[model samples]
Every structure is written in C-alpha cells, then in structure tokens.
Target: MTKANLLYPRKERVRKKQASPNFKAAGKSIEQRPESINKRDNSGDFEIDTVIQTRAKNECLLTLTDRKSRYQIIRLIPDKSADSVNQALRTILQEYQINSITADNGTEFSRLSDVFDPEHIYYAHPYSS
Candidate 1:
C-alpha cells in the first residue's frame, strides 16, 4: 500500500447522503394530499411539470401525466411564465377530466390554484418527484 493508504488504513467506503430539497413548496404540500392519490389505482389523478429543452430555448414544454393510466399530455409554450402555464392548464382541463393534480412548487406554477381550484390541486413537496 502507498503511504497515503497506510495513513488512512483503507477505511470502509463512505455512503453518499441523499440531497435535501433546496426550494420550499408553497400552498398545499404533498403531505396534505390524499392517501388515495398515492395508491395510483384510480384515474383523473395527474402530475404536471414544465420541461425546458435548453437554456437558450425560449419555449418550454408543459407536461401532464395521469398517475393511474400513465397517459401523458405535452404542450409547447413560447414562455414558461405562470400566466402561460396557467393558460395551458386551462386548455388541458377543458379536454381532460382531471379530478386532482400533483405539481412541483415552481414559480411557473405559483398561481396554479388561482387558475384551478386549490381543493383540486396538490403541490409536491421539495426534493420529491
């Protein structure tokens, strides 16, 4: 063994700790969401997220997925602001029968409950899926 290995005595490998959430979730937290949503047996429970293709790209994708059926819906938007996302969601709700939604607590979704009823929407806590 090298001098450094001898000095360290080849200790056991250290386990990496899971990263904690950096951002705070506002409005209803994942904990407050109904247990039934976690079951993922019934339809109408959905999760939504925004995807930016690249930093230079001005447009973003609004993604919605049904937790039960795994049905995905994607919409392209010129911007990822709260107003744009809220309008996209409004259009989607007109087409989909979404009973409840789980969304990340991002700035784009800050006013989601204003667009949709707070009772029908749940924001996923930070560091969560």
Candidate 2:
C-alpha cells in the first residue's frame, strides 16, 4: 500500500486549538531570530536535528545543515545520552567552526546549552506534549 493509505486510513481532521506561550524566553522560540542567521546568505549559522531508529534502540543520527551553503554533516551515534550528544556536537563544531546553531527541543539537545554558549545557540520548543 502507498504511504498515505498505510499511514492514514481516513481523512484526518485537525482538533486542537493553537496555544500560545506566555513569553519568549531565551532559545525557546525562533520567531524573533536574528535576521543575519535566517537570511541564508551568510555562513556559520546551522540547523540541527536528530533521527532515531525503532525498538528502543540507542542508535541515532545527528544532522546539521549550514544555513547559507546548505552544506550538511551527519553523525551516527550508539546512544542518545546528553553527554554523548554533547561530545558529538563538540567534535562537529570543532571541525566545522560553527558560530551558532538552532535545534529542536529534545532531551539529547537539553545539554546543548552547556556545549555552546546561550548567546551563540538557540533551541525550538517541542512541537507538542
């Protein structure tokens, strides 16, 4: 069966209302991100995300993309602990000289604040609970 047919048996309907947060805390939202980083014409800024496998497996993939050149770097890891993720990020940043990064709010990324200075990195809030 096709992906759409297998994933959704029927047309889905949106049921939840959009909830807004009380305030914009540091690294919480990207709404007011620096224009220099979003322009994609200047290099150094990056977007990061992780991909995980099935069955409670610790295996994961870390992906980073340069905002300007669209260049990407992928790292495979055996586990998702904060220390491991931080080590991986440090290695990558050391090699690439990343000045700033934006990432999703995942446990693996919580320690990002420790890896990079808060003034240099940002994290998006979790999509949903």
Candidate 3:
C-alpha cells in the first residue's frame, strides 16, 4: 500500500535557497562551446562535477567524464573548495590531453580556468543544471 494509504506522516519538502547574483563563472559560457564539442564528436571534451559528502566532514569526489566515450575519472578530494578541485584535477590529468571542459557555476569549480586553459573552459548557466 502507498504511504498515504497507510496514514503515514507527511514529509515536508524543503525549498532550495536562491543563488547569489554576485557569484559568476570565471570562464567562458557554455553557449560559446564549439559545435564539435556540442555534438560529442571529440574525445578530449569533458564535463566536470563534484559529489559532496553531506554527512562527512571535508570530503568529496571530483569527477570528469568524456562526452563522447563516457570515460570517467574520479578523484577523492579533501574539500569542496576551488583550490582542492584544481589540485585534484592537476594530479589526475597530468599525463592526459584535454580539449575542453564544461562545468556548472559552482564555487568549487570557480578555479577551473587555473587548472585548464581559460579559453577551453565552459560554464553552464546558473540554475540550469
């Protein structure tokens, strides 16, 4: 039977807080991504994301996935800060070739341009994830 049919207590939905207007991406917008990257025609093109450990203290996973091959690289980072992300990427991609990276406008990704080329970095629109 459904929870409603069982007379279970209703759970309240928590609304997400609004994002600040002052926070902006430090790199190019995703709209400027080349057509080859958009069509997943390139191998080195990647998308980046972070998986934070909500219950843990200062631990997260930084991920990069190739758009065409879906190959993924995961790294355990100490924190969600931009510096941590940049360091992790540098260590993870030392021997690899990169074309471009598309990431959300998260604070942890603010320093992406420092790790990768500024011209090769693309940021998704705010709240567009």
lDDT leader: 3
Candidate 3 — which residues are off by over 4 angstroms? 1-23
Better of 2 and 3 by lDDT: 3
lDDT of 2 by residue, 8-107 (tens): 5766698875436763434656655688887776788998888787875688888898988889999987787778888898898778878788887667
In order, candidate lDDTs are 0.84, 0.77, 0.88
Give the per-residue lDDT of model 3 (tens digit) for 1-129.
766786776788998766688866678889899999999987999899999889889899998999999999998999999999999889877867778899998889888877788989999988776
Tens digits of lDDT, candidate 1, 1-129: 675758557667888554366655657778888888999878999998999978756899999999998999999988989999999999998988998888887889889987788887788756456
* Candidate order by decreasing TM-score: 3, 1, 2
Instruction: Give lDDT for model 2.
Output: 0.77
Off by over 4 Å in 2: 1-28
- Number of clashing residue pairs in every model? 0, 0, 0
Clash count, candidate 3: 0
Off by over 4 Å in 1: 1-24
